[model samples]
Target chain A: MESLVNPYVSVDCVLLGFDGEQLNALVVRQSGNNGEDVAGIYKLPGSLINLDENLDEAAQRVLKQFTGLSQVNMLQFKAFGGPDRLKNPEDSVWLVRFYNLNHHIDRIVTIGYTTLLRIDRKMRKLEGGYEAQWMPISELPRLAFDHSAIVDEALKAVRAKATLDVTLLFDLLPNKFTAAQLRNVMEVVLGITLDVKNFHKKLAQMPYVVPLEEKEDGVNHRAARYYKFKKLKNKHI
Target chain B: MESLVNPYVSVDCVLLGFDGEQLNALVVRQSGNNGEDVAGIYKLPGSLINLDENLDEAAQRVLKQFTGLSQVNMLQFKAFGGPDRLKNPEDSVWLVRFYNLNHHIDRIVTIGYTTLLRIDRKMRKLEGGYEAQWMPISELPRLAFDHSAIVDEALKAVRAKATLDVTLLFDLLPNKFTAAQLRNVMEVVLGITLDVKNFHKKLAQMPYVVPLEEKEDGVNHRAARYYKFKKLKNKHI
Candidate 1:
């Protein structure tokens, strides 16, 4: 049987992982000719969707194939279908060689999907027969085929979602975390440096961030209080 | 010259309008055989994107062609690509006749775009040689294809966006709006009845909603104070 993939539509996954310090995005390097250097040609893990799978299924499959992680909650953020998306000769060449296409594919509307993962919790082993790594978002080199713009949009979407859904923040943190840790995650995600005093005041206003009875066990400085995310039935904002 | 349309990808728009009292969505009726009663069948304004235009352009074109509106800010929220999207015989027959397809089109992934409009402000004249009207969201009939789910998702997306960006709410309101009007918009979008006192307290804390030196005139009931939206330099949440 022939492969039943839709060449005009694809899905890309921006798998963001936080390692308690900085945010990183999982990217796969496009292999070059036998020994040629293609270090600068990294792109988001993506593929054209199969005829039988839905979009969400394709996103999940892409995430699993690239990162060797499954069951991660992914959000479909945007669809990128610019006519000039494949205008770059390098990108056109890569697509033809990568997918072994007999004919030229001038356009492909790719749906961008994103998900947040705890880097410390989930152990990542690159799969899908590609050279993949977690590159810190700040240090991401020039990506292939408008992928940098896709990553930028993913970051914006995650920030917008985190603002409305407090539970999303906890996904990047431990089960019980100190105020500073929570603040660190917010600062990284929001791309802003917040004042400690004001952050605590704002955190206090969030009734869902309930304080636990326990405090930090061991630390060089003053031990801080630990809090856990509590989901309220009628929580707004 | 052959048409440069890409049959595998399309754009669907959810044009939501607020009439100060209720929310409505613009839907186009698929005409039936020579004056046949196709009142029960309604679908969102959509079309397969042309190879020359991008996704956003396609969405704008769909909105303009269906409702005679242009330059509307439409946000791409989700992509619907289920294999069974066109499994309905009625939908398949309509698609074949409408697009004049020579071969079977088993799948066409649609990008969902949405925007809010003030029903009383914008004069809508249906175009694109189709019958169209604004249907109350509360009384929407069973839509064709997966549009019902798409509309539901659009509403959820708009509500999520409204919770984060106060400016989006202002789009549905006039330049100067009363407190009740704002609350009513929120109640309809959120699908919740908020307490008047609590809502007032919450509004008071928002620094962006600036009070104007104006009041409603020529009203049967007590005149209400007017307020306007102010974009803050560093607003969060």
Candidate 2:
């Protein structure tokens, strides 16, 4: 099928995943004009929206095409479309060659979407021409095309939502996760080392977090009690 | 200067204003193809984005042109870019004439921005060719161009933020507002009547809400004490 390029609209995905200990993001390594790998250059998975496609479909296509993952819940956070969003010389070079963006079509506005995943649960592998990696969000390199700012905004959205809704934490943990693992995801996303007493105190108040009968298995340390999020029927909060 | 219209890009504003007793929205009356005023047809303020303009600049221009207001803090919340967004017969008839959209450039994607304002405090008036009104959100008409859905999402964003931050209430109320006025705004926005005892109990716990040594004057009913939001200088929520 011919690519129905609109040149003015695109979608970018910030996939924040967790591996039990740290927060990570799925980023694709952008290559230079010579098809040579550029060291330390990564970007959030993105693509130009097709003329006939919806924005959400475009976002899902970008996620699946880059990370080989599907059926993930994504939330649209913000739109980043400053005129100078592509003024970086390297970004211009990459887009002009790879995306067929000419001078007149360089000022594209991109919609940003975010998703949190349990990377250790699925263990999905990347399978595309673009080399994708799960890099720690804390140690992120300078990204291309205003993506670092996009990631910052996505992180803010995640942190803000995580505070009110315990169900969102389930996206970053296994079916049965330790309280420490849940607290670690919150702390890492909120960028704060929460007090041990205060953290458990807050969790105890949440009726949605149900303690399972089973505990952590086969770990070197003491087995911690596991908990899972229970959806409250007909409750809107 | 020319329009510089990028047919595939546009800006839509969901300007939610509070009018003391109720939450309201600024809506423009959309016209018919023959330059006749379309009865009962309203839309959120919107315009085609200029090719040389940033998304934020485009949104500000649209808001200013429609409402004669500027310098308000606005947030880009979502992007709506369905292929058939403008496929409705009435929407197409209006846009094809006003926007010069042809067959090749019919699918326009719009970035939705939201801003909450104190209508009584500013008293800003609409000054444009199209008639605009501050309609109560509870009695909103069926809006054009997927705007009702956008307004719903904006309300959700405002309500979600309001629960965590008392400072957001200041946008809807005057500097020295009575507790009744404050609770009315919250009740209207959240679409639920908060219990008087429970609401004040929650407010008492919020250190940010400082009770002032003043009372509401020139009212038919009994005078009520006034309060204002006091941000902690070195504290984080």
Candidate 3:
């Protein structure tokens, strides 16, 4: 059968989910390598896109196939097409074996996409004989292909977006979050340490961050007031 | 001879330049179609990448070949890979004739890139038998293929970056510009009008927008004070 996928182009998704603490990325174990050392290696959930699908559609299909999540907003951050992207022999071996390619493939240009998800909210199950897991960004294992660099670029893109759009933070936080939780989201996304007082002062200036009457119920420390991001009628700060 | 360029991947550059007033984009007339109407249609300066070249290298090569300008910073904004990007029949004809390909070409995934330039500073000469011209953004002609959409996306990316980095505005402005010129850059790039007093008040808060001792001369009316962007050791607001 003729291959339905494009041989020279692929999409790699950086599925970053916040676990209410640190940001984590979803990675899948590579399969069908005949028990080689590269068989169990982790890689970003991605593959060569089908000829009939749009790039975004291909990314969405990859995201769903690996994590069983649909309708998630994914941003195309960058395209990795270095001449030596497949310099690592292991990458070429795994690709040829896994894809069952009869012809030699020298290079594949992969587009990098990213999305933020709440870890507790989404139900994730590994599919297609592949094992998947969410590993914290700091402790990520060495990824296959140029995926480590892809992850770093994805993080930079997410941080750049966070600086402009405040609502991106709401995607990672719970429905009602304390000021500390908000600060945590900001710090983790932006990769910076913020003083509590200064952060609160900055947060107070944003009209979209509405304070709720409810407070934390069960906690060891004092119950902190909760805040919810209010949907503004106009452009957000 | 075997084709050196990758048929499946290409690069399109959106070279925007500020002419001390409105922002303009550098576009080139498509050639080599026996003087057909499609041959004269304008498109963003772009072409497919060589098998051995990186994406950035391909974009840089195209930029230099079209405009005779080199070493300008370009940012990869997005990838356009819709299955029907070549639904326009003219596009397929142009591609086949331009590349002299024997096989059927169904799709080409083109990475969109953008860069800001000062029109008065760079000596732009049309190269490679193509007539290149800078058309004001407000008066861009109907472009071939999906280039109109690509230009729009590039403008959006530049505006998004302008909000985060002040240095981006300086790229379009003269070294020493009046306050009105600065405001004009902000308005044109961000696509918004700013009140003179309010905008000046906001500019005052930015420490990097240093005021120069010299004022504008040879003006019909009272000259406005000149200001230059001071490179900060740290981040600029």
Candidate 4:
């Protein structure tokens, strides 16, 4: 054997967007790549790291390409660099196509990152690529590589994190929103019906929920005052 | 390039043991022909999988190697096959160590699985070249490749699971252990002081804990009756 070929590591971003009634996962179209029979089938926003950049930075760059938003929070959840998770040649899993791997083994690697974003059409103008669409979380399409698996893992993480952290809920709610709309979003993400009284009782305990000057308008019932959560950097128990 | 070499997926086990107070990570001294200096230091217990082996089965096989105890509960927390998380002579972090890796990278592709195990010295003793030892979880020595980081990630996972699942706690406790002993182990693993009363209350709610007639003889304070956990398959929730 002459020399072992370096394995490839790519970054995949599983961006989740939550609306008031349902949850959606962000997927992108793969086009103009190494092999491209499949054009616009949805997949997690992903790309190979450029020669000059680091891994986390590479993921951020990929997301920015899709959303035109940079410096958003992200993390590496799992690395899927399987030699054969990509057995089908025509599939996106075929990213494992490494040259000179025959001379020696090439173990392909890709890090999976999950991000929760409050994205609106106002976020960015689409160019060259198709616009990002929010698909129902449960109804995900046949994704490329182990992306379905990645999506599954990201959902588990989101559910676990949402249970303990209200900070993510804050991210989803807008500047001024009705409590009913807020509860609807929370219920959708949590996948359970929460008692209004119990939820209000729990929310009352948190001092961070500052009562805003704003109030709901044109409601059939009595108008409710809108409250905003004061950002707590080091939120401790 | 010829047909791309199929990528292989393997699971590495980072079995952790919490003997009363401090935590220790299980590591094996590998005796193979990859890197010579790696023989003495710690790397996770791992193995390459059979072509037909599913991810979980491969991980279980790797975990049981040290213990000889089959059906040892295990978890695949994260996949860590970074094509170049390995040092390669091609292009890289291993630019200095590149030549060394050029000679190496093809040996194996390892995914890490972290498990909390009941420590038994007999299980740790390997017949051949591999030396299995329980080293302090905090002060683990330099491990082979990124095995050290894999172990750390496993620790985080083991801790997280311990909090959410009672089954993980059973792995830490003795067959018949006092309530205080169980709570102590939980605190050590979690690095938190859980409310003792609430912890026991939750334990009482769990169906698995079978109360034993045994009690600690030497204890000066209130002696708590020992309870052993009934194992369940994937019912950690």
Candidate 5:
């Protein structure tokens, strides 16, 4: 199995997307010879990087192919590698010399990646005849490999950032939104609803939020004030 | 490199032990050669598990073999696998079916492990002439694959736990120790010296950390009050 490690390194991406009220996972039911060595499982959409491709390109390509949606953001998580973690052990897969192994199985090493994508609730119908559902983070089934734990870690990160990083709320907004609609997204992600009256007051104070002086339409009676986040490149902290 | 994704799965343990104030990586530098492959420098001891071996057993056996020590404390991080993380796609090292691409390279997946052991610091010499240094975690060099990142993540976990987990400070103390020594380890880990008057008052108050009758030696002009953490089974959380 020492002969099994290869000429390319691959990354697995666990994408998390959110709406106004729910925190969801972007999972695709796996296809191929479902009944072969591996069967009856929905795993992360992962693949090996091309010989000339950088890791980002490989991850983006795999995500697009599996989800049929493009332009989502992805970030790298920790890497995984160890002996006997492979499906087939009798080749060069053990060639992953970085992982120190003592057992007989050839070691497998992988760089885990994550993405926070805007959900195209409608385009999900274009997926490969496989059921793709936005399962709540807590109820994910026994995932293939250590993916369950992977989601656990990624969620911690999302929750942590929800408080400090304001950009995440963009996922929940439907292109044009009222301040009240935007506040709903923040409440869901924060796991606690803030004082709506005070929240509106704070939004009005931020210089970057430009009030359009337009009113939301199709309401039962009086429409609410609408605004857009003045687009500014985030100067990373 | 496509040939490198083995269906077989396994785990790897990256055991980190702390002695008093400094950090140590429990690694065994190995040497072997393939046709044109050069075994370059790397860190940590590792192994693969038998088909019937539980993840915990594999980690324990690997730890005993590498350190001649058993009943060590540890945690599993993640599993890794992506075909072609290695260079040479072939040449068998372990028993699993692995596809190695070239000399000194392979696609591998590994489950990471982190631990805190109070091994006799004098027994630091590697049995096989492999160097095992209790080097400061801050000075780790570029490891093979993404191992450097693995250790980095572990350190982050340790740092995150420093504030709340009482057991984390135990590794730095002897079987019995003074509350002052425990506080010192916390300061080193958090990278900021805490306010002593309140820190001492707080540790004594925690139900889990009972004050010991013992006090420090004459080495200190004023012997500090000693306290010990109540021992428990695997303080992983």
Candidate 6:
């Protein structure tokens, strides 16, 4: 089995995006033997590593191929390996069809890389026929193999980083956003509603996240003050 | 070369311990052909993974072999790989003899795991002939291969975890300790002098780390009150 596979190393990308209202994941629909979409199940964008490239390079390649974007801020979060990780009956069946792995080669040790991207015009303008779909993280179905666990760990990493690095929020938000919009994204990630006044007060204390003198326009109700995050001289304390 | 070598995954353990005052790292001395200790150079305990074992199992195996202890709390921190990681001229020369790698295969990707052990009676009672040494992390000299970078990353993870998990300090200290002692450990780990009054005030707020009715005995000055950490229902918030 070892002789048959090039190298058992693979990379999975948990590409997270912010869509104003909810946090989303870029998952691809699985394809069957006839190249038809398998309708129900989806998986993270991933691929076996080429022997020529390193782990980071392989991760970047997979991210680019799936999202049609380069220079994504991907982080190598963890490596997942277990004897039966790939041999789960359903997962192996898919592997046999898609990857053509021999029955004996039933395990692959995959590195997990995660990145957050804004749901901007380029993301919305993805080419036709691409099998990728933006699924809200709150409503993600069971993913292939151990990818569900990978996404869980990536979310943990992001949440931990958010408290220390303000730039993560900036990357996920629009150039100018109201304080409520900022708090909503954090609430979505944390799965808990924060006290609006307290949350805004905390944001106000930050040297970054500068408030604009102007108020939001084109809204039905009263206008709200806008804010933009400024780059920190040092990202972490 | 691929056919000649086992699966290319390796595990390096950054075994750390605290000896009351300073933080120390477990580094093994590499010996040359004639059984002479290679003068000042040292490395973390590491080995290639067995075909049958997963990454965590491989890490445990290596940690046990080097430390002669079990039930070590090990965490997989990172995976480091590049085309030239193992191809350093001096490092390759040493690997050629020590690991007996096939001359053709010069690169191996390694996963890094870190474990913190209490430097108590058992640790002090190890047999005299062990090649491993507990060198203070601050005073550590340059290590072999890319191990120094691994140690740096492990320290970063530990420091980050310490801020969130007070139980980590319990693992490094005795069953009962003084507030000053606790503050000293945190100071060493963070490399800063914490305000004694403020530090103790914050600790007082935590339900855990309960103050004990006992006090330090036989000290020159007034004895300080001792404290014990209570097990939390859940460690992480």
DockQ of each: 0.34, 0.35, 0.35, 0.18, 0.06, 0.30
Instruction: Supply candidate 5's per-residue lDDT for A88.
Output: 42
User: Sorted by TM-score, highest first, which candidate order results?
Assistant: 3, 2, 6, 1, 4, 5
lDDT of 2 at B94: 78
Models ranked on lDDT: 3, 1, 2, 6, 4, 5
Residues A123-195, candidate 3: write the lDDT tens digits. 3434334567889999998898889999999999988888778677677878888899888888998988899
Candidate 3 or 5, higher TM-score? 3
- Give each model's whole-structure lDDT: 0.80, 0.77, 0.81, 0.65, 0.58, 0.77
- Candidate 2: tens digits of C-alpha lDDT, residues A1-237: 021223367789999889888899988888755666654588888987876578898888887887667767788988888778878777777765665434545677889999888887344455246677888998998998899999999999888887676567677788888889888887897777888878778888888898889998998999999998887752211
The number of residue pairs in model 5 that clash at the backbone is 82
User: Candidate 1: which docking quality band?
Assistant: acceptable
Top TM-score hit: 3
Q: Give one digit per residue, the lDDT tens place, for model 1 in A42-158.
A: 889898787678889888899788767787778889999888888788787777666656677878889999988777634355533577788899999989989999999999988
* Clashing pairs for predicted structure model 6, backbone only: none
Q: What does the interface RMSD come to for each candidate?
A: 9.0, 9.3, 8.7, 8.0, 10.1, 6.2
TM-scores vs. true structure, each candidate: 0.83, 0.85, 0.88, 0.77, 0.63, 0.85
Poorest 10 consecutive residues by lDDT, candidate 1 chain B = B1-10
Model 5 lDDT tens row, A23-88: 667665543433222334556667655544555667778778767767666655555544334554
The residue ranges of model 6 lying beyond 4 angstroms of the native Cα positions read A1-7, A31-40, A89-106, A127-130, A164-167, A196-203, A234-237, B1-7, B31-40, B89-104, B127-130, B196-207, B220-222, B234-237
> What does candidate 3's lDDT look like per residue over B96-134, in tens digits?
777766656788899999998888844344423566788
Error of 1 at B27 (Å): 0.6
* Residue B11 lDDT, candidate 6, scale 0-100: 82
- List runs of model 2 lying over 4 Å from the truth: A1-7, A32-40, A100-104, A121-124, A127-129, A196-206, A210-218, A231-237, B1-7, B32-40, B100-104, B121-124, B127-129, B197-206, B210-218, B229-237
- What C-alpha lDDT, on a 0 to 100 scale, does residue A143 get in candidate 5? 62
Error of 6 at B142 (Å): 2.2
Candidate 5 segments whose C-alpha is farther than 4 A from its true place: A1-13, A29-44, A48-58, A67-113, A120-217, A221-237, B1-12, B32-42, B48-57, B68-73, B76-105, B119-133, B138-150, B160-172, B193-213, B230-237
Which residue segments of model 3 deviate by more than 4 Å? Answer: A1-7, A33-37, A121-129, A197-206, A211-218, A223-226, A233-237, B1-7, B33-37, B121-124, B127-129, B197-206, B213-219, B223-225, B233-237
